[model samples]
Target: MRFNKSIISISYMLLFFQISISILGTNNYIVSIPYLKYYFDIIVLFATISCILSFFSQTIAVKELVFIVLWLVVSAITLVTTKDILVVTNALMIISARKFSIKKTVQTVFFANLFSLTTTLILFILGFVSDNNNGTVNKHSFGLSHPNQLGAVLMVLILCSAYLFIHASKNIKFILVILNIFYLLLLNSSGSRGAILASLLMFFVLILFYTKPNYLYSICLLIGVFFFCFSLYSTSTSVYASGSILNKLDTVLTNRVRMNNVFMTNYGIKIFGQQVLYTGGSSIMYHADYAYLDNGYLRNLINFGISYSLLFYIYLISVIRKVNSLNLYSAYIIIIPMLVYGFVEEGFTSFLTNIVLLFTSILFISNEKERE
Candidate 1:
């Protein structure tokens, strides 16, 4: 028997973001290979391989049909790596914890994190794996950029998995708080300013400034946003949009300004995948000042085109719209995090972790059955 169409469509769209990176990683940045490409390049490669291995072994989850549709689109435009497809395929399996047992839910989230986090930590350890007389800058193995981002991602997953486990298995808020403190610190320390800021933004906008906020909350939120944006305006844009912005405020508004300029100028919008038209630089100099907006909407418009950007936003916002008025905290867990973290890290743009999120979300959200 066929499954629900809504689930299929949502899942497929979620997968579309990953399809872009198959051509080249580094977010289209000019990657200078130290030895191999960077560790993240390898991570994506591994994700694709792992995903493909799962498929051949018949361990592939039966994804929503829309996933097939999205896959076709991916195959048509970009080289849909086996690894990338496999990552989405993992989400296709309708995961549930033995008839809604919280224990199962906690374990599922935790075990999943264990696999990803262990891999990430290994990458971290491997950074110092080599013996080099000169400080040649291991740019790839472990650096300020890739591994740190991966580590931050794993850290967030660790906290979230712990949250799910604590509540599901034993209902311990204290443990959740302590772990969350560590998560926040790791998020900030990982140098992923986006992840750190996004988490705070999620907590602020979704939790504090959500609706009719009390006066104190409103004042506090405004102050926070003002100070945050102020700081981002002061530093650098590349880091904020590419990484995280909260702790550093590092350079978000500049990125947004550039994007806003692009949108203001019609030439910035690309219908098909054309880098020249959007990035506003000569082909030769493209790599010199090549930068994408830290803002999510801007990045889409710049890379994939404005139309794709709109579609992506619509799809993401749908999660909120669908969950609206449902009063589901589980749903809030994902929604809040995406909104917060998305500002900097491109959480939605990331592959393996995002699949875990989208799959887990649909499990509890009401929208899965809406168009069934």
Candidate 2:
């Protein structure tokens, strides 16, 4: 796969900005940078326009064109209703990368995240950035705004590393093992049960990919679908009723079920989207009360609307199917765990944090080729 050099550079720039902003944006210190918010907006705007112009220079298949038009229209509506530009920007970034090599794109994202995480850690170690304890002695945020944020970033990095190790290096299994051990230690230190479980699940999937290749695709699909449905069901039940089982599950999820219930009760689901102020974790320092919806499925439904949430899920299923057909097990392996993690973490919604979201372009591009 070949791309114009200028297009490739622009895409890398966009990826770097998105990854850096998403990772560092969670840092209490980075957020304090003067005009940082405006800088992000300007970068996004520039990238969006550059991506659109680049698309015009390429020959898009009819089916691909239709998909892009429909997606952009929906994203525009989501932007207007949700007041979140990340959705539209994410869509554009994926569209822009349709012609680029998936391996190159994944490598770019992996290195970008690696750099961002390293820089943040160094700052934290130097005492330039303060770690958030959230009034807990056992949990540490590692210079992030919250402990979960640290775990979530590590989870993303691990997923990326796993993909690269599997697809890009045949001799790195030992290194991968060491990395997983290190990740487990960090996750334990942060007390992020969700990330810990998700990372373990990812490791299990990777082992299954080698030990039970035939069952890999089906199992992954089932896990993703089951968790997504479970997320919806748990959130709904938490809002209306409670039971011993529900209480135990809520306790295990650190009261996320109850918090989601609070958000759902206050602001019902919307078809378009609505603005909801989230406060909890480090946010409690400013707000008197604590409230936050950590479930990605519910968060998208409440913040981006049912339409966007449904379409996003449908798109994910489609990508899984397409990648399975293409024998892209690396992508499949990375995506499924992220899907499961979404049940407990909201970062799964962002393309920057969840690189699997960018794999949507592969589905469209492959479809176009098949048509040809």
Candidate 3:
């Protein structure tokens, strides 16, 4: 069934709000009151439930439905045992894909990020945000808990800006152009090198292919992916090889390479996923029982284990096929930045990534079925 526009709009808006709050750190940015945070969480919960209900109104293959159920069951199991609620919430987003068309989903996400970024800038102007220059070139959190978090949020915004700019009406096109310039500045201020470069590259690729999609677009996407991966590998290798001169670079990652090595050595990979001690020194504490793996791919491996991660990858492959079948190459190109960013950061874990991807995935699935 076609869902009510009002409900879908509210749900998508809340989804982005939920993500903004998640990145903003419930304890610090907007409301420090415990009950207020709980109330917001409840609102987001209800919205997700509404979206899920809408999802089932449409026809779906029995096998596909079964796969979704199994995924939820696995997610619930992981949540109860590991207490990583992101697993369950992320599943909700995946289900959300069916509620709207690709263009609407893209527009919603764009507006959501716009709302988020606007609020953040206002907070920063009012001196409500943190401006801790924790030795980075620009450690402006802009209401987020960390510079990197702001960088990540802006990365998503930048991508959204690029997509919307391409598809926007003449009246809004000028605003988007100006917004793109500002987004780049924000990215720089966030002092996240990986996010900055990856975002720029994604934006550039999307712009290049904005006019039309072609068979060769797949090859172009593969090339983009290769360059991203190589850039990440080269950066990490060079930083480590530089020795003491780039000790700060190592620290910037929170010594993630070392931390990852230690954690793997101590706990090792589990077949079904298990909780371990947090390895970072972040002041904000939520689920203190499990150690934070900043890397999204590794986080999935350690949290969901090989079996579950394999299922997730399979779903991603299907989504890729759907988009490729439709020749929505720009949409396909967008996922590359996040995938590359996930290796060094928590893009896969972050709500910003999930919200954007969920909508895109739904768009692909819907388009694929139409083609058939």
| Per-model CA lDDT versus the true structure | 0.39, 0.74, 0.61
Residue-by-residue lDDT tens digits, candidate 1, 1-372: 133333333333323323222212331123355543554454444434433332332222344335434533533242232223332332322221101222233344444444444443454466523211112342222322353344445444543544353244345656656666766655544545555554564444434334533332334334434533542342333442544543233343324344333332433445532332334243343232434344543444444544444434454444444444343334444445544444444444443434323433343335434322
Stretches of candidate 1 exceeding 4 Å from the true structure: 1-71, 74-114, 118-155, 158-167, 171-175, 202-267, 275-290, 353-372
> Which scores greater on lDDT, model 2 or model 3?
2
Q: RMSDs, each prediction?
A: 9.9, 3.5, 5.0
Among all candidates shown, the one with the greatest lDDT: 2
Please give the lDDT score for candidate 1. 0.39
Model 3 lDDT per residue over 1-372, tens place: 234555566566666566655544432344455554574466348546745665644567676577668767877777776676666766666666555566666666666667766776787778776565445665677666667767877887777666666677987889987887988887888888667866877765675575455643565456545643442342333444546533455576656544444445556667667776674444234222334566666667666666666656666556656666766665654566666676667666644564444643443354634411
Q: Estimate the overall C-alpha local distance difference test score of candidate 3.
A: 0.61
Better of 1 and 2 by TM-score: 2
Candidate 3 regions off by >4 Å? 1-7, 23-31, 36-40, 135-137, 207-254, 282-292, 360-372
Q: Model 1 — which ten-residue stretch has the worst lDDT?
A: 93-102
Error of 3 at 42 (Å): 3.3
- Across 1-372, the per-residue lDDT of candidate 2 in tens digits comes to 235556666766777777777667657684378755575586577558656755754677897787678768888899997788877876776667665566666777877766776888899998878888778899998887788888887787787778777865556767766866877787788887777777777878888777876676798788887887777677555433456566778877767777766677678889878888886545542232557778888888888888778778887888788777877777766787888888888888877677777775567654433311
- Look at candidate 3 and tell me the lDDT of residue 74: 76
